[model samples]
Target: TMTIANSIPSEENNEYCNQFHSKYEPKEILGRGLSSVVRRCVEKSSKTEFAVKVIDLNNLDTNSEDARQDALKELRILRLVQGHANIILLHDHFETEAYIFFVFEICPHGELFEHLNKVVRMSEKRTRGVMRQLLDALEFLHSRQIVHRDIKAENILLDAEMSVKLTDFGFATEVETDDCLTDLCGTPSYLSPEILVVNMYESRSIRVYGRPVDMWASGVLMYTLLVGSPPFWHRRQMTMLRMIMEGRFSLDTPEWEEVSEAAKSLIASLLRVDPGQRLTSVQALAHPFFAKQELPCVTFDRRTRFRSAILAVRCLCRLHRAYAMPARLELRRLRADPYTIRNMRRLIDNTAFLVYSHWVKKAEDQNRAALFENSPKMDLAAQDSG
Candidate 1:
């Protein structure tokens, strides 16, 4: 009889951690996926935190032999993905009799979906910044002949400084053998038109296409970011599929008033109905939105500065919670960090920073002028009230 531990959830009853069992102590549940549950754990020896994804073989649709084969396939594919910043970093994976464990780098900030929902929307400049990094990641993956079949907001995560990191490779497939896959699997909203058509007809003769599918998904994501909801939304799945297949949508929203024409044009290019017409990662990189933007200088001191600034903010928030002190104290400490101040100075050198600075200054001046203009009216009203 299997006695369940209070620490593990009932759904994960069939799974148990065995690899490096002596090192890590499970802390809390991070999330639950279709076939696995991820937990945050701390390595006792190094005091380093990691995310452990436990997949139960008994819960899967496969027998022991098939489970082993699928595990090996996943491992091989994960190993092949090298030096991609956008993809999640897989440290190690091991299997026990009843479960498979995968150790990954802990992303403290959580998924992009959560962030976007919390904010409701992001600024065009910030959105472009994020998209650029995502494109770089995709470029690296496509260059390695890998197709991240699943690319959506949920799979994209944020690091401490709000840097984007792509996660979840369970649905990813590599394009190594010139094999066209027919398995239509991905979030429906982001699915390309071709996928909708195949699914509509229930045709097994259809084959999985190449990297363009990812590009189409990227376009959908771009649209989602610009407009609060997906390009096509319907109460019924079939109606949604019809909209996607027809490629009929308009961006003529009041929100478009604030977004740049260039940005809108890029979105149009990426969201083209024809996969072949969609912008490739390299071509997208060359767009004005990402063209010649200076990336942060890669240096040990710079890295330390950025990390310290982020950590200080996190620690300050935690301290405020624990001690019931004013959060401003944390802000003061953060501002006093010489490293952070210097990094801010360097950040001003970036083109984006310069553009933002100009706008900020202009807005500040206008605000001051508006206050002055309103003073006489306010004074008149006060006099009458008095």
Candidate 2:
């Protein structure tokens, strides 16, 4: 477990010494990945909390200029993308001699990975909601010509209402066309077959694959959500690569049987071996699975689940900052206390239900009124079209 040390007065030798301190006070370390460490910080002026991803360049494999170029590319891509709900908002960034700092929206509930582990397989409805949010984010990225090479549960963050925030653009790259890319990157299990086979051994002379890589990852995520594990998992790396090449998957599991056929069909479409045949974000959105669902109702009560979760996290964060205690200790205490988690979950559920119900009723009323008002116009259009 990562520990958060008390904030000590910065010495002149500290790498962050040169960077201008934002109004937000530094709080605690969130988690560390291969090249970066995330810390929970708050703006002193606004008292708004944020997550800061501090990337240590020294840790990167700098044997060649390729590593530097990739790092610079990620920074550039993130800077290019602005406000989008499904995407994690990047507030500000700077760099020092040792590290690059990226301040982002603080997600309280943590990674989707943890959430998936805690719950049994989510319902098809819940899965659809998450998929919708993810597609929205991905669609936005694809529109900007950015391909998030890595898309997995761990990279998705959840707010209090369990709203999805697509994050970690470390492996993302901009593409000019639907070309096959030979970059051997991303988590092993989520790698598309073309990437795994073509990119791994043949370092050069491989085609440039585009956005489909992301779509493939989305399929893997869908599979994990519905079945509770990756479709392809092997004890050996060689076997896993072979399985991926063969496009072999088994849907005979008991858990797989329980998932809706519509959801399974969508996953199958997304997991197509040929990138061209895979479902585009827009096509996936138009599928009956998503089309049948009502527009997401945004209500104060509906927002409650997330609000309560955020509040609890904020409270814990405040306590951690004031007391200078380890974050793991705080999390353990909160997690151990069933009352805290349950109350928070209930608050979100109840609030969401109330908000959704109110909106639905309002929509029906408005819909009826609109039908009467536009009756003549509707009849004319129907007749003209006919």
Which pairs of residues clash in candidate 1, taking residues 3 or more apart in a chain or in different chains? 181-208
Candidate 2 lands at a TM-score of 0.70
**Can you write out model 2's per-residue Cα lDDT over 1-386, one digit (the tens) per residue?**
22222232234225463353534467778887767778888777788899988776667767435555666777788887768888888888775555567889988999887776555347788898999999989999998888998898889999867799988887888788868456688877788877865766655344667888889999988988875567776646678778776778866644465667788788888888877788988888888778764788776775788899999999999988987963333545443442234344345434544443333221212211121121112243345568
lDDT of each: 0.69, 0.72
- Cα displacement (angstroms), candidate 2, residue 85, comes to 0.5
Q: Using alpha carbons, what is the TM-score of model 1?
A: 0.69
Residue 350 in model 2: lDDT? 44
94, model 2: CA deviation in Å? 1.3
